[model samples]
Target chain A: MALKPLGDRIVIKQVEKEETTKSGIVLPGTAQEKPQIAEVIAVGPGGIVDGKEVKMEVKPGDRVIYSKYAGTEVKYDGEEYIIIKQSDVLAVIE
Target chain B: MALKPLGDRIVIKQVEKEETTKSGIVLPGTAQEKPQIAEVIAVGPGGIVDGKEVKMEVKPGDRVIYSKYAGTEVKYDGEEYIIIKQSDVLAVIE
Candidate 1:
């Protein structure tokens, strides 16, 4: 099953680092204060949300940095994804 | 000094219950999960915030119920108040 976000929300999945590291080392991401990086999987049509005008800026396949505490975790078809509003996205990674 | 909220934000102070109850019993609000009731002290101008058009609805002296965890606590002149977005307010008490 595919997850389709509603409103100004978007679904994103953490972009896993390459498993083959140059030093063959793996560092877990839980011990840092850095923002999370994820790839957008689905984009919602933006309009009026909560009486506010919202325009969707990110699209599917775009890498983005989002607020640390934002987004709701949803499991779909045994795959985990985060659903967050466009406002929660801090920036797009070029 | 007075606090001036910005961008659809509002400064509110928790409404203190009457010191004397009919039964002379006092119950602290922290023990419950009920939404907090606050009185608006300052209101910001409705404008664009984070790329979204926001219109301020509540005014000073209005009583409102806001999202339980949606405000920032600020201490000014030894008085405590909460600053939150207007969207955080769920309802206004008539």
Candidate 2:
């Protein structure tokens, strides 16, 4: 089965904490609330959401940081993925 | 001090559960969770938010139903308020 997000939503796989630490990227969350680093797997088409126009900014393969509490978790094909809106993505790592 | 929310945000004061029960309004939350009924105290001027254009829907004095985990709580002038995005407000109670 395939997963397709809707309306500026994105699907991502969490990257290991050790790998993120090795990259030396600073996370925005506090010690008790550490933000997550993940790799973009799928991106939704930008369109109107809640009466507003949203443009997708991150593409598949891009690594991004997002709030820990943002998005919904889904399990598919024996793998877990997080589905979140593009707006919840705080930063993209180059 | 007064709270002025920004970008489709709203400030609300939660209504007591007893009052809601007496009003016979069915809440959306499950047995373990209960959605809150709140009175709109302040509304933000909707505009560009996360690159999207948002227009405020609820105005002051409107009662609304919101997610239990949706918003940030703040104490101002010895009173408590919840600050949440307009999208988090599920419905306006007439």
Candidate 3:
């Protein structure tokens, strides 16, 4: 990825929610809500923000849950990526 | 507010998009995009996440620009409020 996030921002590639856990069952796109899980591709260096020291805890290759609809979607190289601040991330999945 | 956000979560009251700037001019809600501006009504306690120390910067009463569609809407006593993670906030308005 060519995009590097600044501040506490990170680049994410959304994970498509599985609709076909059982064989021959296709639950259609409309049935699924917007995907909130994503994999981190790039991470920004954390620094002073509003005069407070901020340290980045999540890094590249981390799976995270972000706030729903909490990012600016970008299309790069024919693939979709979403950039969101570190704070938008709800939790890191191990 | 009776609700307190845990971790980096926050409660925000959305700002009404001014559609009637010109006198007697009314724009339909359907024609307008989702509002992104909101006032912070509650703040969360920040602590270690992923082994990195995090600090809270924005506080209550700060006007912020959050990611569009980034919050869970709630109705409290006939008023609306949105709860979102701090990372969902894009910028703080001076």
Candidate 4:
């Protein structure tokens, strides 16, 4: 099944973290904070909310940063995904 | 000092949790989950990000829901406040 966000929500897939940095040094997993970066898969349409127009800012293929503990995790088509509100998205990564 | 969010960030005031339910019975604070609802204070100026234009959805006086683990807490003007990215805000309460 495909995942789609409703209202002001968006679908995200967490980006994998590298075990090593650019210096080719291995870092312990416990020493590293979980990365909050993700890639946008689907975006919900912006509509009237609280008598105000809510517009979508991120689009498909855009990588973004979000809060570490934001969104609901679910497994679909045997792959893990997160569905969160568009407001949960912090910044789009270039 | 005034708290203003930069980029796609926003300022929030966490809503105080009621010690009692609607039935007017006092309950222990430990029995209640931290309220994720907040009131918007200052909003960030949405600029260019990853070739997209970000917009502010929630305005001042708007009540919002956010991730419990989201945002940074700070004290300003003798009041506590949180600064989080707009994406950290889940929904706006009507």
lDDT at B30, model 3: 34
TM-score of each: 0.45, 0.49, 0.45, 0.46
Q: Which ten residues in a row have the lowest lDDT in candidate 1 chain A?
A: A19-28
lDDT of 2 by residue, A26-87 (tens): 56778655688999988866677776678888999999988756465544445666667788
Which one wins by TM-score: 1 or 2? Answer: 2
- The parts of candidate 1 lying over 4 Å away from their true place are A1-48, A51-94, B19-34
Q: Write the per-residue lDDT of candidate 1 for residues A14-59, one digit (tens) a residue.
A: 7666632442434344533346778898886667767666798999
TM-score of chain B of each: 0.78, 0.86, 0.74, 0.75
Tens digit of per-residue lDDT, candidate 3, span A1-94: 7998887788988766462222122222112223255689999888875555567777889766565445799999999999987767755544
Cα lDDT for residue A76, model 4? 40
Off by over 4 Å in 2: A1-48, A51-94, B26-34
Model 1 residue B49 CA deviation in Å: 0.9
CA displacement after TM-score superposition, residue A91 of candidate 4 (Å) = 28
Show pairs that collide, candidate 3.
A87-B87, A88-B87
Clash pairs, candidate 4, are A87-B87, A88-B87, A89-B87
Model 3 C-alpha RMSD vs. true structure (Å) is: 11.4
Those runs of model 4 whose alpha carbons end farther than 4 Å from true positions after fitting are: A1-44, A47-94, B19-35
Q: Go through the candidates in order and give each one's C-alpha lDDT.
A: 0.67, 0.74, 0.66, 0.64
Question: What TM-score would candidate 2 get against the native?
Answer: 0.49
